[model samples]
Target: MFKSRRPGLVRRLWRSRVVTESDGHSGKLHRHEQRSMTHTDTAPGLTGEAGDLTEGAEREDEEQPDDDRGAMCVPEHRGSRRGQESDSRTVTCCLFGEWDFRPRSSYWAARKDGAGPCQCAPRRGVLEEDLASTAHAFLKRLKERSLDALVKAVETKGGIPGECVMVPNTELRLGAHHISPYYLLCKLFRWGDLPLSARLKPLCHCQSFGAVDSAKVCCNPHHYSRLCGPESPPPPYSLSRSDEHKPLDTGTSIGSVTSGGHRSHWCSVAYWEQRTRVGRLYPAYEPSLSIFYDLPQGTGLCLHGHHRHGGSSSSSVQQIRSKIGFGIVLSRELDGVWVYNRSQHPVFVHSPTLDPPSARGLNVKRVMPGFSLKVFDYECSSWMAEHSVKPESQEGPWDPHSVRISFAKGWGPCYSRQFITSCPCWLEVLLNNHR
Candidate 1:
């Protein structure tokens, strides 16, 4: 729980690892038992794994198909909310905004029942003339196949959870590049589009079809969780309304977020040198957001001081600091934590939310300049932890809640060096147990 605190106490906590924010009172620091980064001795360990820097470490990759009329239900009424009743047939397909976020593009127009939460904010409609006819046709075809999958299941005396309906992996073309069939289908039916290879899990009945780089896969929109994220959008997220408001622009408050009159922190941002902690812990709480940058700031995490590259002897302290540039801004929202790469260079990120459900693989994303990503999806994170895996390899480190990000350069087997300790500058985003 968090409450408005004496400014002095707030300042002290920011300047040091006060660890536990008070419930308008005081408490002790805790090393929460969450997943940790690899090379624990050399990496910035999480709560319970805390250790002073004796050394260094840190660091950190979808489809569809088609069918018939009895294959799907005919719409009687449209645009209703869940729990509220209507005369139309029940929607046997995915519905955007049902997955922890607001919808993107359009919603289920032919559905008989209402949709889910935080009803989407009014969005400006796209002009038909502006979009290619092929794009519209592709989307329409997708909807037909989505419901057709359900109809097949019902016909066989099975249900939405019965089987994976086959689909072309690259069925739709938008602009110059092709898009993942399931991704676009999910965007229209599941929810908003995401940047990271947001993994989609097939229902138990469709699990056999879940895999990477498959030429053919399931197209049942309801087969995948409505919470589907992107799977490397080489075509770009141009299809989603590009002008929509950004996560950083939200007016969420920072350290003063509260729950039951006590303070609650979503996560703590820590800058590091090899394994040594640099600066104070920047706790991003709910209702507000904060930034981690190299420049002076009235508030948020300002990464100052010099850092020496333990592994790379050629780079100097000034060079490492320069790499920070404007750094990134990490925000805590009711849905999850977001990171905006405000710096000039790309930042490599690894988080539990980035774990692909189908393969159980941990992906390190390369977030480029001026780009932002929902680094952690709270709902997804919780779901992953339930079926958590302890990856014991250099390519992966298991943590359903914690996140690690390396700046400027990258680490791991593909890079010149391995481990976050070799990274000149990096960050450890340790999520709070309470969140």
Candidate 2:
């Protein structure tokens, strides 16, 4: 399980190629191993372990010819979400053993860590949106146009990220954390494996003007073109400001989650941020070239840090508890600054004026080492108490504020003058002022 954290493991998984006959017996063995382990049980005894696995392997060997027969064929329901509309239709595969739909080696490692096999859950929202018709089609489009579109978009909107910002897989991530759209797009499009003809130019560039002018900038113009257009609006959700330790609900519609054995959902109260389900994207532009580049700088809105391209700047605020601390990261790449807790356990942020009981909390859990769960209780807790606002009376969704960024300068303390709700520059200044 710890191996998953190693960059080498990920690189190896990403580097594997499709097994073919040219490789002879070893290739056949590997293919058989992949097929057989896709979903075997992992309870204990050899039958539950090795024996069942072998039977599955044999079955796969028998089925290999059928796959070869239809090697060029496409599965019937490859990229769809048409039928299963109800909660009952949300099918979850039983916790599969390590081999479930993966090569034997992957199965062994995953089983050891107890990570459940990937399910066929109608694909996630971002994927569905990107591959609206088909994953293959989406890949084709990305290959055909995303790079050009990204280049053109960056030429227009300066917010485009460059080579410096890391893009993670196609999952929602926060600005304060590592991971960026560049990483996701490359993985999804198999950009790394493609020949030079298919490779897109790196988006990073030198600033044309500013004090840090010529400073290297991360820009994916194609995607950025769509972002700053009038069509894009702030995501329609906001989370409570404090750490509330809410349980994750298994049910959909209501936001809840599972941890260890306990399950808790965010409070039924529909806060603004939670309303915008993190990790989802809407088609943001009307596909254009000039419009993408002509847009003003700083028009790119923050995704409250929940964007595929985690933003670029580290937070200006850092509050240290004896054991834990919290900080906010702001990036011109994203609109809202991210409020992240450095604590292993849940740390609360609150308004100073509020009474203790009235404040809300944003409970956090460790998703990755150094990264904690981004959502929590609605209370304005201690984390925010040092800021100018009195903690007790600060009812959140946090109060809306504006930011003023200098196009030539990029971003600064003055950016807070504008009314962007997601960035916590005010809190940073408030704490700095007190200090």
| 1-435 per-residue lDDT for model 2 (tens digits) | 343333332232222322222223341222112111212322211222111223223223323222212211112221123444421222212211211334453322323322343332222222323322232332233332333444333333223333232111232232222223333333232221111111122211212111111222232322211011112122222213221111111111112235665444211111112112233322212110010112233232232343223433332211111112122112211112122221122222222321344444221111111121212222233344435554343345543121121110001122211222232222211111111
Query: What Cα-based lDDT does every candidate model obtain?
Result: 0.44, 0.23
Q: State how far residue 248 of model 1 sits from its true place (Å).
A: 12
User: Which portions of model 2 miss their true places by more than 4 Å?
Assistant: 1-133, 143-435
lDDT, residue 90, model 1: 30
Best by lDDT: 1
The candidate that wins on TM-score is 1
lDDT value for model 2: 0.23
User: Can you write out model 1's per-residue Cα lDDT over 194-268, one digit (the tens) per residue?
Assistant: 322344434323432224445666754444432112333222222244321111122233444466788777677
> Candidate 1: where are CA atoms >4 Å away?
1-260, 286-293, 296-298, 306-317, 358-362, 391-398, 433-435
Model 2: ten consecutive residues of lowest lDDT: 284-293
